[model samples]
Target: MTALRSRVAETARVYRLHPPRVSLGRVVATPGALDVVRDHGVDLPGLLRRHASGDWGDVCAADAQANDLAADPACPARLLSAYDTAGGRLWVLTEADRSATTVLLPSEY
Candidate 1:
């Protein structure tokens, strides 16, 4: 398998073995996110996995200045952000129960 896919699989396996403190939410892609997937050929699920795993940095409390991944440190993130290797930024918002997550580009918000 490709390295990226392998990493994703490994991350998934780790999560399966020991889930995070907060349950992972269902991942959905917005229209603009789909467009980004088409344009940048990103593995959206992998990106989401990385974010869910807290592999991302640069946390911000507010949606503003979210050109990159940002999350509130105090609370379980209602939202998470990350950037792909190609420099594409993505934002993920989780439901109150953390049962659902929506992935979108920064500009889409």
Candidate 2:
């Protein structure tokens, strides 16, 4: 995809847990793909620059806050999102410029 060789996706996912939670997504892009976005002049670091974007309320997390969700089968959706502090309140942006939908767990189990 780029002049640089991409790493094999031996594993991939998006995860967040301060309370042992799980989230999921289909377009599970690696941080490297995000680097590609950065190469295209997207201020990805800016995502970490601000706690939120516009009025969407996306919290910008620090390097110390990053985690993995590749092997998780929890939230099978299009996009993966979190509250940066609360996994019980995780969400997904189904569409651009759209509101986030909460990921609910079935209490049957």
Candidate 3:
């Protein structure tokens, strides 16, 4: 699968058991923060709501300043998928990785 597809698959597999706590409602944050949502299990639409609900400038400005990986094009898309059965919180995805035997969390991102 493609990188984004891989991420989506991993997200789907991990989130079924655990749910997320908070969903950021800001649009201005880095792609990484939004990717964190993919890292959890949330979808694009949900993310859009979160973004539209908050400050897109605040959320995105820092990434532009630091040029963080969150600004990457794929990060945002990778996080949203059909597999987000749970809310797909980041912490939960991390914990699931520890519990499993796979390196679903790509080190590159």
TM-score against native, each model = 0.58, 0.20, 0.23
Candidate 2 C-alpha lDDT tens digits along 21-107: 332222223444344444554333322212122211233443113322221234332333332211122222322222332232222
lDDT of predicted model 1: 0.60
lDDT of 3 by residue, 4-101 (tens): 66765654454443443224332243355456556655564433332222212122354333322322333431122112223332211111112211
Q: What is the clash count of model 3?
A: 12
Model 3, stretches more than 4 Å misplaced? 23-42, 45-109
lDDT of 2: 0.27
Measured by TM-score, how close is model 2 to the native structure? 0.20
Taken over the whole model, the C-alpha lDDT of each candidate is 0.60, 0.27, 0.33
Per-residue lDDT of model 1, residues 1-109, tens digit only: 8885676567667755543334456777888888888887776766666566654423454543342233433444365655543436777666545788887777877
Quote the positional error of residue 106 for candidate 3 in Å.
22
The TM-score leader among the candidates is: 1
Candidate 2 — which residues are off by over 4 angstroms? 1-32, 52-109
Instruction: Looking at model 3, report the run of 10 residues with the lowest lDDT sum.
Output: 94-103
